[model samples]
Each structure stands twice: as structure tokens, then as C-alpha cells.
Target: MRNKIRIPKRPVDTTMSKTTIPVFIYKPEILRTDRSLVVKNHTVKPVLRTLLFVLTLICITSAAGAQTAEELFNKGLESFKWQKSEEASEYFQQAAQADPNRDIYYLYLGIIYHQSGKLQEAEESYSRGIGLNGGERDRLLLNRGNLRTAVSDYDGASSDYSAVIDAGGPLSSSALLNRANMELNRSSFLLAVGDYTEYLVREPESPQKETIEELLNLLNTRLASDAQAAATAAEQALLEEERRLAEEAARAEEEARRAALMEEALQSLSSSGEDTKSISAGSENIREDFEDSALED
Candidate 1:
């Protein structure tokens, strides 16, 4: 009996969100110019006050419009935690642009983009963070792998998971499970079995332990059935070959028997011809003796 192994689908939540969503609320810092104006005359003092009020208004506007990169990232985080993905994405994009060197900014951007279902953008953001040598390299790879898997890029997803596993960290066990699922999707049952087994070993207390065990059992059963079928097919082929050889041997034996009978018949015919010639010679000698006796009389 064939057993069907049903691999579970990946959750829609971003990999970073699955780990933890930290909400950071930092006050935005605004840049303002402090200009010291000295009015020599009393008449110019009123004008200076008016000019100061205008400068204060301008500063307020600047403070409202311009936010520091850290502030934007914090806002993005808070928005993401609140499930405001669009708002979070905007803030993350702004933060990344303002502080291009910061890996965390791109990381959040990737997460937001992934949550928003913008796969291409999410991949680009993750790649950017990886290129920057982010401290959360494993997290980036995991998120990218998840995205790649969603898009049916099984090979790329496997590579990303393999990298995370090779790095050997807290996320390695998670990578193992994810890569196993991807392998299953690719119909690589043996590879999936190995990864699932390794993951279970590493994470004995994992929440997915029971489910993974069931899947492993099913896979094992399927593999055993396949092996049995292959063995049966090979045995059948061997029997057919034996039957064909036996038929050929039987035909050769029959041909040899027929050739022997033909040779025996030819030898008998040759012996009969020789006997007939001897009889003829005897008859001729008898006639000659009679003729000689008559002539003498």
C-alpha cells in the first residue's frame, strides 16, 4: 500500500515576527538652527522679535516634517507590532534611506515587505541586509528562505536554510525544519527525512515534535512500500529472462534431434544402393555360366 505524506504549508507570518516583534518608541529628533540676532537700536528690537517668531515657526515645521533615522525605525517597529504593515513599511523604507548603513533598518524593511506580500521587495531588502553583514545574519537568511519557499524557489530556499544551519545558532533547528519542508515540496523524500530527523534530534522539546514524528512515520512507510515494489519488479524481470532462455534451449534440442534422424535415413539409403549392385553382379555371373554350357552342348 502506498502512503501519502502531506507536508505542511509555511505560515504567512514573517520569520522575524515569528521569533519576536519588538516595539521601540523613540522620540523624533529634529534639527533647528539657533541664530542669535543683536539689534543695536530700540526700533530694530520689535523687528528682531518678529523675525524670531517666524524662525520659531519654521523650526516647528521642520521638526514635524523631518524625523531622525532611529526615530523612523522605532516608529516602524511600533507600527509592525500593531499589525499596521503598510505604515510600518513606509517608516522602514524611510529609515533605510535615511540610514543606509544600518542593517537593522533594512531587516525591518524586509520583514514589513514580506508581511505585505511584496516578495520582490522583501527579497531585495533581505539581500541588502545580508550584504551589509548584519548582526542578525541567520534571521535574514531564514526570512529570505521562507520567502523563496513561498515563491516555489525550492533550490534557493534550500541554499538559504543550509547556510543558516551551517552557521549553527539558535535558528539552526528552525532552519532544519524549514529546509525539510522545502525538500518535501520538491519530492525529495529521503532528504526531507534526514532533515526532519536531525531537527527532531536537536529540538527534542519542540512544539512540532508530535506532528513531525507522524510525518516521519508516513514517509518511512512510503519508502518501504516503494522499495518492495522495485524488488518485485526486478524479480519479475529475472523470471521472464529465465523463461526466455529455457525456450531457446528447448528449440536447440529439437533441431539437434531432427538433424540426427535425417543423417540416419541418408546412411540407410547408401547401404541399400550397395546391396542392389552386388545382386546385379551375381545375376550377370549366373547367366554367363548358362550361356557357356549351351555353347558346349
Candidate 2:
């Protein structure tokens, strides 16, 4: 018999809260209960980045005034921690509406939507955030690009990543790392190498230094292999073409030789036939003269 753990429902808090977003935290289901659990080692995706900018929102609206946008955003984070994703999204949505100028509201909403598997909503949330015309466009672009990549929108994701790099900020290094990953997936080994090289240059102390180095080495080997394969293919094609041309030339020369032989044979046969005819004609004249002498006798 197997036992099932029931997740408890909690009331949503509408108060201002403070907690750091868990960048690499395990799934909530793991921490809930441990019972007859099959412990298996499975590969998980890595968390790319955390706050390049400190976000501190600890303001709650007074009873006399409406709830502040910061308070709503903080409340959304609290709901998210409690595993109340839908409620959290609502809070973030309200926060976004309350303050159209604040991009953080939309960023939170985007993250929540993305986690909830609402991919279209997630993308639109990021775009909406960017369209708000707020600060830290790089962060928004990075997040959006990651989302796009997750959904297999390679071209759109690539464009966003390139935009991040062109924007020129601390996150540009992260963007480079992401773009390298993109190129790697596409088997553009040399392009990936360039991106990885640039990422290392921009972030000398990158936390992923060892992993990046290993990947770079692997990519270098792959690039060499691919180049060798291409060269071999081209050489083979050239050889095949040369061989075909050589065969054609041989066939043409043989045909020409055959034609010349036939012409020479025909000329020899014609001359022989003409000499035989002249000899026959001389023999016939001698016969006629002998006949005339017999008649005189």
C-alpha cells in the first residue's frame, strides 16, 4: 500500500513581507513529506542569475490610504512562498495595475506566470513589463529571453539575448552565457565558442567558471571535428567531379579514335577496289583484240 500526502491549503496574506527569492531551491513537493519516496538522481536545469540589483519593498498602505504598489508586490512574493501561485499572480497583477511605472510588478507577474505553465501569459507579462517603459530593461529582456528559450522560440530568444548584450550592463555576461547555450543547441560550435569566450572576458569571476571551461574545451574539440568533416566532404566531392570529367574525356577520345580508324579503313578499301576495276578493264581490252585477229585469220 502506498500513502499519499495531502497538500494543505492556506489563506493568502495581503500584508507586506520580506524574503529573498530562492534562486536554486528544490521543488516544494520534496520538502512537504518524505514517505516511501524513491530517491533517484535526475538532472535538473541550472538557475542562471539572481539579483544584480537589490529590491527592497517594505511599504504597506495605511488604512486611511489605498494599498501601496510596493505592498502588493511584497504580498505577491509571500503568496509565492506559501505555494499559492494563482493568488500571488493576482497580487502582482494588481500591483502592476496600481503602479504602471513600476517594472518590478510585471517582472514578478512574469516569473509567476512562467512557473505556473501559462507560457503565453508569461511572455506577454514580460513584454508588458518592458512596454511600461521602466528602468532596468536589461533584466526584463534577460528574463523574457530565458522564457522564450524555454518555449523553443530560438530566434526570438536569440534576438532578445542579443538586445541584452547590446544594451550593455552587468547582465550582458549572463546574456552571453545564454546565447552560447543557444548556439550550442543549434550546433554552431564556433559561434558558441565566441560567446563563451566573451562571457569569460566579461565575467572573470563567474561562478560557472569551471563548468564553462569544460564546455569550452568540448566545443573546441567539436568545432575541429566538424571542420575536418566538412573538409573531407568537399575533397570527396572534388574528387568525384574530377573522376567524372576524366571518364567523359576518355570516352570522347575513344570515340574519336574509332571514327579515325573507320575513315582510314574506308579509304584503303576504296583504293583497292579502284585498282581491281582498272585491271579488269585492261583484261577485257586484250580479249577484244584477240577476237578481232581470229576473225582476220
Error of 1 at 296 (Å): 33
- The whole-model C-alpha lDDT of candidate 2 against the native structure comes to 0.76
Collision count for each candidate, in order = 0, 0
What TM-score against the true fold does each predicted structure earn?
0.61, 0.68
Put down candidate 2 lDDT per residue, 110-204, tens digits, no spaces: 88888889889888888988887678677889989998888788899899999989978788888989989988887778889999999889888
What does candidate 2 score in Cα RMSD to the true structure?
A: 12.9
Residue-level lDDT of model 1, residues 1-297, one tens digit each, is 222222233233341222322222222223344754332455545654555545434432343245677876886788789997866777777777788998888888898888878889999999999888778788999999999999999989999999999999899999999999999998899999999999989999989899999999999999899889999999999999999999999999999999999999999999999999999999999999999999999
lDDT of 2 at 244: 100
Q: Which candidate is the best by TM-score?
A: 2
With candidate 2 superimposed using the best TM-score fit, by how many Å does residue 144's alpha carbon deviate from the native?
A: 1.5
State the displacement of the C-alpha of residue 283, model 2, in Å, after optimal TM-score superposition: 8.7
User: Could you tell me which 10 consecutive residues in candidate 2 have the lowest summed lDDT?
Assistant: 47-56
Residue-level error in angstroms, candidate 2, position 204: 1.5
